[model samples]
Target chain A: MKLWTLTEGNKEFINETGSITKFANRFFIVGMKPRYEFKELLTQCYLIGYKSLPLVALTGFIMGLVLTMQLRPSLIVYGVESQLPEMVGISIVREVGPVITALIFAGKIGSSIGAELGSMKVTEQIDAMEVSGINPFKFLVATRIISTTLMLPILTVLADAIALFGSYIGVNINSVTSFSLFFTQVFQGLDLNDLLPAVIKTFFFGFAVGVVGCYKGFNSNKGTKGVGIAANSAVVLSSVLIFIIDLLAVQIADLMGLNY
Target chain B: MGNYAENNMRLGIFVLVGLIVLIFAFYMVGKNKSIFGGNFELKARFSNSNGLMKGSNVLYSGIQAGTVKSLKLINDTTIEATLLIDNEVKSFIRKNAIVTIGTEGLMGNKVIQITPFKGNSPLVKEGDLLESKKVASIDEMLQTLSRTNDNIAGISDGLRQTVVEINKSTLWKLLGDKAAANGIESTINQMHQASINANAFSKDLEMILSETKSGKGTAGLLLTDTAFATQLRMALVGIKSAGDHANELTLQLNQMASDLKKDLDNSNGFLNFLVKDSLMIKKLNATMDNIEKGTDGFNQNMEALKHNFLFRGYFKKLEKEKEKRKTIDQSLRIDK
Candidate 1:
């Protein structure tokens, strides 16, 4: 029985991977179609990006604060506590700001996408849309994926800015740094390479999170319990994909000689 | 439709703000790179770029004044770097500035440092080639450091061996011994005594030096008394004149002695005969004896003449005349 169950799990894993790839490919096809869901895409962008700002800002601010406070003693040990802002800036602009914001985005946006579509699937709304010749894939999946793809980079940028601002506040918590000086120090260490790669990777991160969430939701079981499972799995898978994408992004950046 | 439009407006605003933030980031990075500002191109050449790349920072006196635009290896040993420098720093960089490649931090990116010279020179113009300085690359520095580390290790090993040898020697044992301690103590005591003597000698020397400083002694007078110095100089001049006179006199005496010696050397010379001829001396003695006898005979003849009566009358008349003249002369000369 254990052998059978392991075999079944492997098959299920392969099937899930194939299904997601198919869904992503179908999204690409439907998303590039003529009737672009401009209004819905805008609504999703508002929902995904603007509405998520407060939480992202709070998280970003806290991230900067906690990281700076935690790093101070260690940096002070090396007598480079003065470079705290530059260090924090490089970290946020390079790695922390995008990755942390994406993780938070996956938790919030990914779960919502999954639960919304999952309930729609359970209620036969998607099927109803398909019968009405609405091309549900274009209306629902493509729009959300495009919105995530477009919106995440913008969100990541805002989040990075907030995080740096938070980092400034953090730097001033124990030691006094003027707002101008803190920002100067931060921008001083940042390069186009650092900013570009981090921003670029968020696009991929958003696409992955959106696809996973939409895939989980649109393909959820016809039962009530499936909605919960879909939402939970969507967040989990999107979170995992965020790390994977981040890894790929770093590798690609390194290959392009942008890692410096 | 109204709600949808409002949502779209919110989304538009959000997207605009994000783009603005991103553009601002780009602007800041570009500004740091000296990209957007008014700038001019300058050239620097280096023997080795030391991993310097395009877009590396150019620091002017430790401030970010520019960035490297391109680096091309012009020859086997020279890398020509084109720099985009801000126009604001144009007045500061001199024509004779030295450019060097250095690291940003311990393990950071390579940076170009433009070190300006202090003296008068023209401000650096665009396209003018600034002098490049060859800096030790990290590899070379590490190589030197490795060699130094090896030397230190060898030295430390030698020191360890020396310590071992010292441990093996009897010195430590001697130091621990009571008898040796006593001998060492005596030696230290002798050294202390010698040091005290040396210190006392130093003090005496210092005292002599102080006396010299006060200008009181002969040395001091010679050094400080201007009037005495002038008198001494006059005396020296007089002595020199006297010496010159004595030298002339000595030279004259030497000439006379040389002439006298020549005369004496010739046996027939009158001055030689007068000086040292024995035969001339004998003849002169005989002549002198004959003169004396003749003078005695004349005296006898005069006495005889006076005794004769005829001579006596003449002599008496002459005597009377001489007496009369003497009386007349005496009377004339009496009180005059």
Candidate 2:
């Protein structure tokens, strides 16, 4: 199939989209039928999810704190200053917590995954693996994808908790609300549907970031410069895909009546 | 191998913490009645639930005691809401408890308020159907408000028409006249003076009223002094009695005057008979002389009889009685 576009950029975009789609299909075909890379998957999970925790936590905490402080005056003007906890809680859990954490993860881990794999290809380590009867894609790409998919939700959960704790401190900067009371207000009238959909969506976020990063890395060219380009493009594309996937998720959640 | 195990352990802990936090969040967000405790079911039927959904708090006498279990439409107008109450506080909710849908905050969720009956009411059993009442929802209030808004619009329209009429009327011309304006100004000045005087008068009146309330003067005595009132009552009674006597005396005088007038009108006046008729005059003179002689003879005989022996004791006793009467009269005069 050919995409007829006047610009080479458009043509390249379509070409990349097709290749990524095929690559994602191949991943499903190959990764699931693996001589299960459990050890590699664990190490990747440790590197991707655990190592990403500090940055995600920092981003989430700042987002929550700043959001509360900004919303404080407006909420006070509306005479609902007490609703700071609840509004911040919902924004973090439902939208901000997962999405922002994913963006940060894409920046840190996407680039890292891309550069690492690209460098391996450039050095012919992947070729060496293939010649030595070892499946490089199975060991590297599959493990990374599975790790990111499994670990991102965990990371998002931790970030959400941290952000809420930050918001608690933010709330205390102006008024005194007990920890229990703050939590009670946050949880009051909240539904499982809200939490489940948000958590479930992060899986797709994780998958998009992983696949884009791996796809960029696998298709890299021109040696060392290729790795840098791969890393940069991986971050950009995966970040875009996070927002896109978020839009699709909102629509799907609305369709399923899981949006509260 | 040791480094690998340590890293794995750290990763395991992090993942465990994340999973724990996620579960905690879900639990906090969705926990209702019977989640961590035994719960008893209670039901209430309302005409309109008015957005009171399931999992709404069932606040028993303003305490969190339960949660709304489910809502079912029995008919077009009736909604049956089942409640799941914690077993710990189940005994407090009486069978006669009243259920009403209330709002949490001004712009917050709807809640079910259960008011406990403060009498010798029995404890609510499992699946008891409690009483319920429908409260006005925000939508209904807004609907009423819109109707009121229409009424206000109509009132303003009428006012505007009245104002326009006034603007076009001859009264507006009259108001612009110099003489009328001067007259109005004079009247207003006089009214201001009158109001000032009235204010002073009112102050005096208020002071007088306060004084009267404190029993200060005759009017105050009449109002507040019971003894003074009793004395006035007695005085009025005496005056009434005196007036009655005076009336009787005046009536007697009137009767006597009328009798004398009748006698004079009959031409039988003694002075007229004596002065106008000569024969009557001669007879009256002879009769008078005879009466004088008889009176003198009688006096002489009484004097002789008083000196006789049998009459002497009686005369002496009469004299003694006179003396005693005189002494008694003297004593009465002294007492007076």
Candidate 3:
């Protein structure tokens, strides 16, 4: 689809919208057969999990550091400087943890998924799979969906942890705080309302990444140039989807009376 | 393969450690939320809840003893809030304790505060109702402030009118005028003059008194000599006798006037002749008729005189004669 794909008439809307649902349904069908897709899932896990660790850590650490530095002075004005760790920790866990991790996932996992699939398309591997009677869609789409579904919440948890550590280090730059006290503050500031909604939204984020990456890669054309287009478009689309999904999640959570 | 395996092992350990730390932090936070711990329930009700909700802090002496577990509307006018508190802190809360709603920071969440009641013997029973203090709402404070502002406005209006009256009143202007100042100054000068005159009069009276003490004037002779006193007393008695005679003559004149008034009322008074004497009346009437004819003749002559210079000169001569006649009467009185 072009950038203005949604601006077209109902026929185009149906074609574009219909394909997403169609792919999601097929991915689910393939995902049910766990034994067949184990190796694929393992490989995806390694690529998404271990490979993405350093980037997520770096982003998470910086997120914690910057947030603490920005929030410290304001808390100090309120004579609440002691609660800085708790405040920063709550913010990171509830909001920054999921969003930053998902954005980074979109940038890293999304582009890689698009490039890999786009290259396979350009090389005629999809055609070869079709000729050999293997379901190429199932093989490619299921592994990504499973891996992303399992990975994003885990990544968010990891991100929230790393961000708090960074905040602790940041706090110690100007003031001393015990690790126990720091964690206490972090936990004390958080409740179910802060934690559950953030964790829940990451599933949508993972789904967006999986579906958009697979769609862009699976639909590649124009030989060598199409691979680059697919990779770039996948990152952009998934990033947009992450923000949109976050907005809807917040609205729904607000309606449900979840205070964050 | 050996080096690669070692690197993978270290990475796995690192990921495992990171996961453990993350879980530990989550558990700590969850425990603070009363998720992992066995907690007892406490409830505080306030008349003005002020936007307090579930999970708002329940504070005892500025320490967070628990969290608000839930809020339920009891009726149209009241809300029941259930709290989940750590079992350790529940003993300190008594049955007679009062709960009031207060704010955390200026812009922070509303918290339920329990104040210990020292006087009451009955302890707070579990699920028992505690008396709630009606924490004044911001609206109530604003209403009082508006009344104060209106009173201030009214006072300022009254003060402004008073000032305007002072500016415009004629009496106020009169007291302030430069001419009035001069009037006061002149009055003060006259008073000074009067005071000086009184002092001089007093000094003169004192001098006269001194002279009398020395027996130097007629007053002194009268005061100093006993014979002079007797003679003066005799002279005063003779003067009183003469005054009595004069008074008797005045009484006689009064009696005559009384008689005349009675006669007039009876038409037999000499004054009644003026009113009833026929010959006198005829003469007076003839004189009045003659005077009328003469006045008419005089008026005709005066009108002619206005046109005739000779007649005007004759009237001027007559006016000179009248003046001469009055002069003659004056001379005659002097000659007599």
Residue A249's lDDT in candidate 1 = 89
Report the candidate with higher TM-score, 2 versus 3: 2
Give me the TM-scores of chain B across the candidates. 0.48, 0.50, 0.50
Give the TM-score of each candidate: 0.68, 0.70, 0.64
Candidate 3 local lDDT, B1-336, one digit each (tens): 675555556546655765686577567656766666766776766554689887788887787777878888877788888878776677787877788888876656788887887875565555666677888877899999999999999999999999899889997899899999899999999999999999999999999999999997998997898999999899999999999999999999999989988888898966889977899899989999999999999999778876697667777887899999999999999999
Per model, how much of the real contact set is kept? 0.90, 0.73, 0.34
Q: Write the per-residue lDDT of candidate 2 for residues B1-336, one digit (tens) a residue.
A: 998888899899999999999988877765643455688899999998878877778888887788888999999989999999888888688888899999887977788999876678889899999999778888999999999999999999999999999989999889889999999999999999999999999999999899999998878879999998899999999999999999999999999877767666776677557656789989989999999999999999999999999899999999999999999999999999
Residue B248 displacement (Å), model 1: 37
Winner on DockQ between 2 and 3 is 2
lDDT per residue, candidate 3, A140-214, as tens digits?
877887777667777778888888899999999998888888877777778777888888899889988988898
Query: Any runs in candidate 1 off by more than 4 Å, and if so which?
Result: B103-109, B135-336
CA deviation > 4 Å runs, candidate 2: A1-8, B32-37, B139-336
Cα deviation of B288, candidate 1, in Å: 52
Q: How does chain A of every candidate compare to the true chain A by TM-score? A: 0.98, 0.96, 0.91
Model 2, span A1-260: residue lDDT tens: 24444577787889999999998898899988949899999999999988898899899889889988999999999999988888998888999999999999999999999999999889999899999998988998999998889899999999999999999999999889999999888876456767888999999999998999998988888999999999999999999999999999999999987774
Q: Which segments of model 3 are wrong by more than 4 Å? A: A1-14, A68-91, A124-139, A168-186, B1-26, B119-125, B161-336
